[model samples]
Target: MIASTIKTQYEGSSHDSVLYSKPYSKKIDTLNMPKGYQLPKFMQFDGKGNLKQHVTHFIETCNNAGMEEDYLVKKFVRSLKGNAFDWYTNLKPEFINSWDQLEKEFLNCFYSTRRTISMLELTSTKQWKDEPIIDYINRWRSLSLDCKDQLSETSAIDMCVQGMHWGLHYILQGIKPRTFEVLATRSHHIELSIANHGKKEPITDFKKDKVFAPNIDKIGKKPAKEAFTVNTTPIKTSSTPIKIDVIKDSTQIKPSF
Candidate 1:
């Protein structure tokens, strides 16, 4: 009885020092890779992607490789990298006793914080002045997924439209697509048409020295006086023949009748 108790204490000590339970460690230690079984490529979660997605993908890959709960619980830490690895290392020993508990803790640790950050990003995200319709819409939709609890299709459309450039928004306002998909499609169509054809620019015809309106500064200044001037004050004329004398180089003309 004393020997069995000592063995239990030793096993419990081993389990309490790591992530897996004592039973999980025992099963995982005895398991061998199947003959010709190649290790499946595990996804490295660095905390950038959706936490739930990362966990789901990790489980799927491990399951496909015939890893049962024991292996999953024991080996999940191997898949972590960067911030995720740091998070795993900081977990209290023996706190996570099963695969489900570990997965739950992983989600609880990262998911809410990520969603909050994503929500802020979504609120502040804007379509760049030169960004294409396809690219901007794609990015906006991706950000929405992280914070999409209350986001409806109409609200999604509104958010995208609000983030779009004013010129794009003006055109989109006129089109008034009813659904987000239709909006994306029509926006892309607008983009393609603009690319294939072009925007209408006002064609202005110009001529030099024909300005009806002068420069604002120039308009305030009086014209310079001319050296030569012609005077025609109804020159005295008998209804008969009158001769007006003028020289080629003269400035003023005097008519005599």
Candidate 2:
């Protein structure tokens, strides 16, 4: 009687059978998954071992999503595309056991000790010319991350200051910043100050001098007189005179007679 009563109470639903049987779940319902939490497309790794940055980013994203190891590995596999997907499929047997092992294998395939050395050399020798101080410093910092064992914050600060343009380098040398953060901040402000000063209107009358002014002395001076020759000889007069004396006396005697 008690068994019949219990059976009657649980007969309305399959909940009892579901509790006893482990049914296969073919699909994962991703509806409840966090939005905008998808793995970045650029974060795929082929067999070439050049995806250190991508791997690092993938791990961080998975961690933030609170994924367990099994689910993490599955999600990671699903995220693979193109060459990366092919590589994963070929080695599925080996990496399927553990997420930790998979990560190590992935790194072994892509990350190289020589790459770290190369990054160290670049960071140590790089220089900033016309690039903005902030951009220059950011690039240095990124390269420094790959060679952290070989470089320190203080060393990075010194290298960055040394790589600056001569004008900025000379000014920053006096300040002697001891940390990278402080050095970056001070360099940024110094750059801004230099830019602002360049933009200001230049002094037009700094050294007003009459000597340098346009020569106005010739402006008021009278023009010089032109020289020419004049004729100095006196005008010649006529020198001839007439003689009428004898004929006039003869005519007067005849008139008297």
Candidate 3:
């Protein structure tokens, strides 16, 4: 009877285990998602300004990764380093709860009014000596974005042309490009033309003789001076029959009668 009871208990346990058994499912690793699909390293905010760029990049990166608002807030806080981390930790619990609120506060803390003024001043930027036209244009365009008022395409093209080197600017002026795209294309061609022209050897008129040439005879000798032997004696003539001899040197004549 004891052997039979143990056998029956064993059979019942086996049946229960089979009924409760689950198939193994592979666990998904969030950190090691497909190669390029993995989350990017968090961008740390330094207090040196450019808060807009830093925050924008962070938001864009998180959005691309399909991170939810909660994850966004957590990742942003985790990414902070040094003073930034300390400042964030000290914020009220409510302030840290909303990602949008956090971003707004972050910008308020870092973005300065002076930066906007500086951006406005960029409209007056002139091309620096030896600065490339393309570089000047690119810098102006970048600064324009930071301004409170965005620059129009025509205004941007004008600013770019105005900042260009005088030589290039003069050439582009004649082309009279109505659009920024046209201006850029024309400027590129002009720049290449100038560069190619500089590389060329200037054509010479070998046909014309040089004004100054080496005189082998006069190399070491002093220039000759004129000497005249004048005849002071009056001529003795009978009925205008008198012979006069004139001696000529390099610069004067001596007469004998």
- Among the numbered candidates, top TM-score falls to 3
User: lDDT tens string, model 3, 177-224?
Assistant: 777667766676667666655666232212241233333365577767
Report the lDDT tens digits of candidate 1 across residue range 174-219: 6667787888877775566445434442221121212232223545
User: Which runs in model 3 stand beyond 4 Å of their true positions?
Assistant: 1-40, 93-95, 112-114, 117-120, 128-135, 176-257
Q: Local error of candidate 1 at 209, Å?
A: 43
TM-score (C-alpha) between model 2 and the true structure: 0.45
Over 54-155, each residue of candidate 2 has an lDDT whose tens digit, in order, gives 667777777777655544555676556777675665573333455676677666655543346454475455555668988888877777766636766676
Write down the lDDT that model 1 would get.
Answer: 0.69
Scored against the true structure, residue 248 in model 2 reaches a CA lDDT of 25
| TM-score of structure candidate 1 | 0.46
Number of backbone collisions per candidate, in order?
0, 1, 0
TM-score of each: 0.46, 0.45, 0.49
Looking at candidate 1, the ten consecutive residues that score lowest on lDDT are 202-211
Clashes of 1: 0
> For model 1, what is the alpha-carbon lDDT of residue 118?
56
